[model samples]
Target: MTVDIENLIDGESKFVSFSEKISLPDAYSVNGDVLVKLSGKISNEKKGLFHFSGNIVAVLNLNCDLCLKPFNFKLDFPVNELFSRSIHKKDDCLSFSGNIINLEPVILDNILVNMPMKAVCSNNCKGLCEICGHNLNESDCRCEKEHINPKFEKLKALFEESENE
Candidate 1:
């Protein structure tokens, strides 16, 4: 929701309330989803100063980084911030004034900052077999020989040459 500065010029306080479903398209590096229930309160305190606080709850459906399987997760976050009319000239932080505040960017930033960098299906996720692309968590593949690094072969050859010399 957008807050108009004109309505807040006189130090009058108001609330920006929402209980709608919001979507996070790029929830993960590959494919992931987050549906949030958002509700918040915002108030104008003084000239160029505002207070924003709220609660957000989300259900996340994402692929496990190791197992490559879908996992359901939950996230709960409390939102609180201050927007001042005077900008800090030397800092990267933002300044707000003239009674206008657009909340979409703020919400998005909070969500992205709090998201998990890596999520696994379980603590002991077996992950996929590198040799055959088989999910080791479910079943094992008969391919015993694993892929070896070409760099290792070169090192081995160097060691043999040194031994012969």
Candidate 2:
């Protein structure tokens, strides 16, 4: 998305808002289309410097890490960016060539930075059964429950002896 600032004058601010469905490139394990809603105001602070402050809201489709189920995650955050029309790009501000400022890069960066490391459908998700590879949240599996690692067998016997005493 690009913002037009050709008619904006110095010391003047414009209120811009838009709701668009954007297809983000597959990134950070996020796939499919996203609904992005941006509402902000852009102000020309000086001759070639602009300041934009507003909020960004987006809905992302993600899969649960534990259950492997697809779900929607909503992200809402504040954004404050500086734009400059200088020939020499500075490390602190974003540089633009013409009277338009590209917002896609900023939006993508914020979304990726705020993405969760682990996604879960719910807090009490049971995940999948280890032996039968069945979704334990739906129903219990018929696999044997007494299977224990040989390394932990001695520990289990010690606990049993202590309980008897």
Best by TM-score: 2
Which prediction has the highest lDDT against the true structure? 2
lDDT of 2 by residue, 1-165 (tens): 789999999999999898987788776446667889999999999869999999999988888888788778888999999999988787989999888998888888888888888898889999888778888888999887777797799998999999999
The local lDDT score (0 to 100) that residue 30 gets in candidate 2 is 67
Q: Model 1, stretches more than 4 Å misplaced?
A: 3-16, 23-33, 85-93, 96-100, 145-165
Backbone N/Cα/C clashes per model: 2, 0
lDDT (C-alpha, whole model) for all candidates: 0.71, 0.86
lDDT of 1: 0.71
